[model samples]
Target: MKLFPYKPRRYQEEIVQTIFDCLKDRKHLIMEAPAGSGKTICALVACLSFVSENDKGIIYLTRTNSQQKQAIQELKRIAEKLDLKAVSIQGRTNTCLLIDAIPSLKEKNMSNEDVARLCAARKKRSLEAMRGKEEWNRCIFFENFLLIKNELKFDRVVAAEELVEYGRKYKICAYEMNKMLAKKADIIIAPYIYIFDEFLREKFSMLYS
Candidate 1:
């Protein structure tokens, strides 16, 4: 895969290479670099190079949607440079927004004719897809998110409530992966609670509960 030419400053190169080496060795890394150190790019380089194909796609969690978008954008920039495809998994509501542009409301405002027309158009296009594609789940999650945002805008097609319904299905927890990856995640990104705060751990327990 191609890589970005934005050379790491004199110091970050070591950190980047160290991260790459640690991941190659399957060692857990908890690195902290100051601003302008290309943390995002370095992380992607390590993740893209080292992650196994059979493992779950890179999971990047953040407190705010903006940070998640920032990470996704940086990964995309690196991917474009390297010609590697990336994935992003988010809340289900966001997924619903991807399915349709308009969030559904209990009250109907638009004409029934227009709603029928939109549904018909989507069905027609949906059928145009390649045969056997319906059974395949090939699109990367993050790529799917981008398509919903850029191509469709997610407001008209997805119902907000339905999106909320799938929130629990995609969450990642350390305890869950401990039996699998020993708490190691490919490009794992989440809040501090999952790491330092026991309360956060218990909250996630309830989520599983």
Candidate 2:
């Protein structure tokens, strides 16, 4: 099967085949390739092939948003050639509508955890207010999120920027939308910290684990 858009050089083909073999044999692999060697696409196509055959999914971990976006772009190209779907998820600070809406949080030198805590507090207050009223006074985006959560499609590659746009256009929380989509995505691209950061890891354990 043709996995890449362009012709794979000899070394790239070798790496892809090796990855396929290792996955098929259920063996661990440690490969080292130089920069700009097409390692991203090679690994992507190889793992996608393995998942297609096994009826499983792929979780790709990177270190930054740029890396995640790069992978998503490559996945999008591959999707043009194959029927594949992928999603790129960043931390709450990057995708959270609540935090983004709060001007204080944007200007203050707050960590992601701190921003998350403040956002959670705001949400809690909004939920409490709902006990007396019929309408939601909390984050409108989050309330609207529940309405369209089930209708989201994961049948195609969605980059972080595109996901945020959908959320904004639909009046939902982008971060929450990503979490919902992650469950159904054929491939999930996230930061490496999601696996090691205690709080973040616990939050995504259900989807990733």
Candidate 3:
């Protein structure tokens, strides 16, 4: 109905119904469908419908950036019919400019956890510098973020890449910007690792907690 953005395809109605039922009943669901069977939109519509009435939120996890981008495209379509805000986030390894900018950091081939630790250290320094600490070198990107964070306004559906570009243009930190966006979003699209990896999961959960 109103939640479904497109006319139902073959078996699409059944899939959506099953998903909505499972969600309402607080049970797990698994769906098997062929390529181009419209699974993404069906799942979004089902989840959106459930959460719209239940006053819950949706966290859509994907394994790759392409998958995350596709999910964001579908969310944009749904947002046309439904008033909602959606954001996609990538891990610090992907979104952090420092990793790309600094040849030393790039040469180190740091893991996501490594990048996160570096980010935390830099953020602390940035905050300290803001408060008149002169010895510690500030993260310029994070410093710019703190300066303009309150004035930033995101679109209804924001992709991680878009945020990255915006951060590059504004000279801010994209990873941190997405974290802020996640707090106000009705639907958050992120990598599956954010939930499957213990360290990332705890950090991701803190945004909601």
In terms of TM-score, the best-performing candidate is: 3
- Least lDDT summed over 10 consecutive residues: which range in candidate 2? 128-137
Q: Residue 93 of candidate 1: its Cα lDDT? A: 22
lDDT of 1 at 104: 56
Highest-lDDT candidate: 3
Error of 1 at 130 (Å): 19
RMSD of each: 13.5, 2.5, 1.4
Candidate 3 residues 90-123, lDDT tens each? 8788889867777888999898768878988888
lDDT per residue as tens, model 1, 83-141: 44333333222333223333452234444345434434544444444333352322232
Per-model TM-score, in order, reads: 0.44, 0.86, 0.94
Model 1 TM: 0.44
Candidate 2 residue lDDT tens string, 106-170: 78867877867866876776666656654343677776776667776654888878878877777
For residue 87, give model 2's deviation from the true position in Å: 0.3
> How well does candidate 3 score on lDDT at residue 130?
90
lDDT, residue 151, model 1: 33
